[model samples]
Target: MKRLKIKSFLGTAVLAFLIASCTDILNEEPRSVYEPGFFETEEGVRGGLTSMYAHLRYIYGNAYFYNTTQTGTDEATYAQSADQNFLVMDISGRGDITPETSRADVLWGNSFNNINTANGIIENGETVGISDALIAEARFFRAFDYFMLVQTFGGVPLDLGAGELAFNDNPVRVSSRNTVPEVYTQAIFPDLLQAVNDLPDNPRITGGVTKTVARLYLAKAYLTFGWWLQNPNNIPTYPETSRSDPDGNDAQWYFQQAYDVATTAIDNPGPFALQDTYYDVNWAPNDRNSEILLYADHTETSEYYNDSSLTYANGGGADNFAVWMMTWNYTVLRSSSSNTEWLGDIESVRREAVQPLGRPWIRMSPTIGAITNTFDDKTNDSRYDGTFTTVYRSNIDVEPAISGPVYNANGMEVAGGDPILTFLDEEPATPIDYSLPPEQGANVGAGVLPGRPDFVIGPNDISRRVYPGLWKLGVYRTDSGNGLGQPNAASTRPFNIAKFSELYFIAAEAAVKGATGSRSARELINVIRARAGMWRWDNSENEERIEDNSAEMVAATPSIIDIDYILEERSREYFGEGYRWYDLIRTQKWEEVAGSYEIAGDNYGDHTPQTVTRSIQPYHYLRPIPQGQLDALDMSAAEKDTYQNPGY
Candidate 1:
């Protein structure tokens, strides 16, 4: 019943001892050592369960890990300020993604730690008379982590140090991996099945594991494993094994199971349902809504609970700063106090801790395909308006501490709350002049539309240095009394991990892969498209906009639905949310979908779009094992080479 609460008691868990606190240098070593006796008590089991939820922070909201998931795909590419950390992941000529640079290490390290903690709870909690329902949460998380690991890095180890799926008290230097089939049949599928059978229909605590949540993961795992078995593209898997399932089921069988489980969850959603409109779903004030099945939680209430200061965050590890990457330096936008000649430039749009504006790192930018192609229906669909910050208004009241009218586009007088800049939804009939120099009042290289009061850039003119910021994932805080508040602070809003809408997607995708269901794939996708067409508020215009274009949206669906259509819908629904790479990988359409992209150069007025090709090799499907993992191994170089995935 609590609003956006991750039970406060999770902070008390002895995670340091359970994870065997390691130095930053050797953090990848899976040498977790929890005292077997601690988890033998009810309190200890509860603490371990809480720690499993807490572990999500290490990966979900991490910006670098975020890059690994998004940059190479069609949804996003490296921006102007991107460094080796981000550029390498783009795979568009910056460099190869080496083991040392791959941020998949975040998942590799944190998931193992959480998996071991889950192992301790599962092994010892039964001795203390812990309830099966309580222990099922551990099983859910253990399976959840293995699912993520297998998707990112093929054939990950199920046995950390002890026997297969057993708790290890002592650290071990050597390790071995389970094949994809073993990981699914032995670890992911079995654990999730138990979790679905035992977890409560409703969460015992806020954001706790539930039957619906377990079913979602179980369904997703089945779907992913089916894709692996099909191997339609013949993508190689390391520590190689035949595609034959241990349970003797074919890919189509697994696909059918996935569809059945997903549709079952969709039918019996417990305390979870889709938000009425797409705007309400990602609205900062409306976070932690029913649509979110799981999230990595942060709070504005206390720094101790937030894991970083709510007042300020330097965009480091464990902070929910992933939103900062796609944010451009909108604060650089300027206006003048004069109509004709250039008077002193005034900061019109200052940074604020609001949904549209946040700390700008400019490390990643959405690909042009994301803006113009994926979200082509800007008028009929509310999703395009809901997803991007296309308009910037003057905020003299918040920053610059000024009081007077300023002149923006066409030397028009503007007050606070007036539009300063706007990314035009589509190319205009009137030309946007990019020839004007910055000193001549064309600040930040933004072109001015004749007779308009706001600087405007058409879709084609969106450069690497200037583009629409991701509005859905932007920062929001209640404490910014009158000024900018804590614009630099990590967002207190929970980083959503799973959503109820995904059940529809999972089921739809499974159905496309040869699973017949009561509902057709088109019907399932239309459910989401209809919701996306409903608009309660306009993000760009910043005003109340009550409109229901659901009929038009549904009518616009193709006569037949396929994988490509499903993927396009996914991008529109979940852009810039770290879902692109995996979605493409699951369908084996990464290379075909994201083989090349187009974006302009990274200067203020540079708007010449150039196509850049990506070198997406088959081995790129699986990320290399992190260098830290290889260094921690007490094995020979040849053995380590054999241990690592090929083409690293």
Candidate 2:
């Protein structure tokens, strides 16, 4: 594959803005500096492909849809910053949301932009007699884009082939609102099948799409479709709703299709396998591990592509948005000259003031009966470690409180020396300067308590709150590290993920559902449990180590697994990854999980609580198609209803 320098596209919003002086100074005539004919050469193709890849970066890059939506929802990553406050509101059922707020818009736009670029390459390439492999690559990319679109918004406006100037001026938008099966039949399945047939087994060297990547995408599509088709949870229209469709066969058929594709992909393992070590699997720079069948290649040089920056404090004032909000109360502290402590001492003190370093916003609420009941046995499982970070209190030796106070129920300043917890052991015994000159003895700040003695500190400590006096540990560094560089700074916190563990659970589910040919359901589940470093069901030799095998031996094991173990395992595995909210909805246990609270917290009194009640109406399952989109479409009532997902 040929590498090219990253260049801004002429028509892109960023580029256009950069070039434009002002709206009043806009030129009427089009600039013809370069022709499409010039872009037909090998270098041109390489540059075009590079541009295409850059667009893909926008989909997966920082502030992109993948980070915003996937991380925002219950797929991966937790929102740690206040900017991601929307996630808490959504998960906790405390706020109203419109489609406009969703990353769906950016995802839809970017995916289609990629598709259009791919289409341009495919269409124009034939005239120049470009390689069949390149054409196949384009087709593969187009198919992948369509797959993403279909999954998010069912039956999107399918734009196939090309268009003329007249047609482009007034594009006749197709209104089939194709069934889930139809989309698979027409767009995804066929395109992938064709691409797999034509594309090379390995195209990494060729700078193009590969059969292996195609297979992974196809398998993932099938798996997602199968779950959607077979599992009633995928259907937007529930039986309790008026918009229920009695199409039962569609679900089963999709599931079967999914199984077939996934099985094929699994059986024909190319370069994909699970990594042995967790750190090597996830944290490594090159995600080009044997396991990553499909992934966007990232490089340090690539603009906005670095993942390492996400974990550390950037010198810039901008906070590490994700880690700051999600990791509970974490902060940074600077040592003053008066307190000439080591770096270790500074970090130690900072660590103490914070409660749990990680946030519990995306946690599986104990209210979810299935999750709560199963994970109740937290001692034996290694999953619990991933779910919760144990907070250890520091052994900071301070003298016991000396106090004198008395107060009535009514507000009154009673006689008292509110217990003073002395931070320092004693004052310097042999003071060098018992009475220092006025010029040398400057007041820096008070001690750890109020009305305490001030000491001489450096100029840096004077401006910034370095001394113990102004230290509000909880409030301090609540934001990610701002532009200013400081020690023990707060940026993004690396939190727990349920990636590999969940895969094991998925494999178990597939086995239990009779999808795995060789392994029995119990055996598959046992393998998963063992992989997670948990106790095996069959290790009955010792009472201290063995798990009760009675549950594993049942005929209704899969159902029981779904009802009890699986949910709990999910909770334990994916506590802060944001899966809890959706899992509750899928299991039809939202009420049990979040019924006690009101929909909105009352702000009537002085101290207004932010607590809100959970409400899962039928319409809540699928968000309404944006009101703007609905208003724009000049459609008949019947057509509108047909196009909209059942609830919306």
Candidate 3:
């Protein structure tokens, strides 16, 4: 009776097919290939489904896609490191991404691996009495791959059947990349709608696709597509430009479709439900709960480890989702400076393990505002607390050195190794509040709230005091509170790619955009708000207010249904579960929100000023086609040139 950890199933017998060892991604098979009749039996179908999941896992499980999603977005503060390639991609900003840049190559070249495998299953599912359920599962994954591809690269090669690659007897691989709309029409929609239509009534399939998963993805696809229809310039050219009218006609229809599908998923009452506690969706005991519709399934035993022998440097434990997001280079490490005398290990109390629960990458820094006021009921909104650690506990392997001339928490110069430290949970929850708290009220700047600065922090700026550590995935050594079982203690936790609360936002967005769903935008949103422990606002109030806990519990509510308000709610709920970048892109707020990433540090103590802008451009909307793939395409020079995305 062990929990089926989403990352625990890496090495089991049947699912071994999920692990692909060779660099030869999508164009061909994995280390092991399923020969001809593999899809004919129940076992085979299940295997096929696992293989597809494995391929999908390759993209989301680690930092690749996650890092790309945050960079310049409002949801992230740059944690620029020289070695992390993807971080540089985010740092590169708008026009700087040449075809030579690796961003497109990694995403584009490998994604097809998912698409082609799903194709193999769909085309041959019926051969060995594969149930309609299994067929639908295959289609659901295929749709999932295309949806991501279109969003990432404007238009990509859409292969519904065994791609043109299989047809040629001779092997000079050449293929045409489809236009974005063509992808939506020819691949994404056909597969998703069919999966939705064919899936059985049940939604509980344990790492496999279910009826609700398909519909949720369908709703998402239509919603993202609707954005392009309204603002064609947001994307490059799509083949079906005729269908996207400037008038509200086509855009409204797409919005309605998104609304309809998301509403059905919500109203149907499938296994997916908003968990009473927001953090449960990502942590154990409930990582595999109903709230998560789409996720990479793993089991407790199948732990991914970073084996040095493996060809890939970051080997083995590919299952862990936290590695890509965490930045736990202890701020306590004191380095020696050249040409300057020891100058007494200078100022600042040791925040040795200020955020010891998880190794934070410090990449996705919530803006001072996001940490403080994004939620009207900041305290009640369990999401803020669930997603981040506002406090630092005294938990680290090394004690601060008893150096002279260093100021501790009290800003006093004590020389001996001060063995004392405080553990504060949700300290300074009035995080970055715009209205400064009363001088005497709420213990202003006390304890860790006013602790010393973090040493040598992010590559983006390299030094700073503290920002709340993203604790959503910070299950340090399974929360043992020490790095003891770390290094290979399971890194893979339940990573939710899609959640039930999103349906509420989808319905809300659709309603605000002029498409009515099964419920009013306010009503749909209220359900999510209530679960997060928020309060409702009076419709005509000059400003929002709850009962101030003077009375029994209540939920804080927004005055009206507007997209900006909805966006903030989404930020509060979905934080680091990985949707910030796309959410901004779809909403056309990328420029305004994540406009310029900043990098400023060198000497950042509690108040020595931090932040300097990084590059971001409008055309950054679509990532470039991986130059390697475009160069590798089996097409004419002109055709290949056409295949590369607009700028890069």
Best of the candidates, lDDT: 1
The local distance difference test score of each candidate is 0.85, 0.38, 0.53
**TM-score ranking, high to low:** 1, 3, 2
* Tens-digit lDDT string for candidate 3 (1-648): 222112211211101122352211112222245543554455545555656655544556556556667655666654424234444555443225567754444455445655555665666677767777777887888778778878877766553223531211122345556666778877788788999889876753465567777888888888888887787445345323454533344777888998998889887855667765555555454566778776654433223322111111242234444443544333443322211332223322233222234343444344444544553354455565556554333222234333334433323333333322221222234342213221211111222233432211211221222444565665433333432334333244545577777887887888888887458887777777666653333111212434333111124465577887778878888776678878887877776665543333322233223444556666677777766665555578887777666655
For candidate 2, the lDDT comes to 0.38
Off-target runs (Cα >4 Å) in candidate 1 are 1-36
TM-score of 1: 0.95
Query: Over all chains combined, what TM-score does candidate 3 have?
Result: 0.75
Stretches off by above 4 angstroms in model 2 are 5-53, 61-93, 124-136, 160-179, 198-213, 230-234, 237-250, 285-287, 302-325, 332-516, 534-560, 563-613, 624-648
Tens-digit lDDT track of model 1 for 379-494: 98998998899999888977547777788877898888888999999999878888878886777888887788888888977878999999999898888778888888888888
Task: Determine the backbone clash count of candidate 2.
Answer: 13
Q: Give TM per candidate.
A: 0.95, 0.57, 0.75
Instruction: Report how far residue 117 has shifted in candidate 2, in Å.
Output: 2.2
Residue-level lDDT tens digits of model 2 in 449-557: 2232222221111111111121100112222232212223422222221132343444444443445455444554554444444333211111234343233334323
